[model samples]
Target: MTVLSQLVSLVFGGLVPGFLLGLLAFRVKSRWCPRCGESTLAMPPTERDR
Candidate 1:
């Protein structure tokens, strides 16, 4: 009983969270462009002095 309980804790508590976090990481994209290394589209262009 004790060994089974420990195994369940390791799988449900530790492994489950880690696997979920990995899955989440794949779905979410950061604000920056990875290829060009540019700031996200939200960034504004610089203004020139007249």
Candidate 2:
């Protein structure tokens, strides 16, 4: 019972927040496009390479 509780806590305390933070970071990063008003990740490599 203790082990199971620990596992649940670890998932909720660690993985959940980590996943949320990663999602937030991705959203923030993708939304920032000062140059072209589009996600840089969506740009073609050739366009950015030059």
Candidate 3:
């Protein structure tokens, strides 16, 4: 029972927050495309984009 509880704690404490942080980082970086390196902007550009 103790070992199982320890394992569950480890997974929740170590893995869950890490996974959530990774997802947050991914979402933030996803604004810029990896191939073209262009950022997704919320507002339209005032001038034509080159």
Scored by lDDT, the top model is: 3
Provide the lDDT at 15 for model 1. Answer: 82
| CA lDDT of each prediction against the hidden true structure | 0.77, 0.84, 0.88
Report the lDDT tens digits of candidate 2 across residue range 5-49.
999998889988899999999888877687777765665568668
Candidates sorted by TM-score, best first: 3, 2, 1
Clashing pairs in 2: none
Predicted candidate 3 versus true structure: per-residue lDDT over 1-50, tens digit per residue: 99999999988999888999999999999899788988776866566773
TM-score against native, each model: 0.45, 0.50, 0.64
Q: Give candidate 1 regions above 4 Å deviation.
A: 20-29
Off by over 4 Å in 2: 33-50
Task: Give lDDT: candidate 2, residue 10.
Answer: 85
Tens-place lDDT digits, model 1, residues 1-50: 99999999877898888998988886565656789877665745567632
Best by TM-score: 3
Candidate achieving higher TM-score, 1 or 3: 3
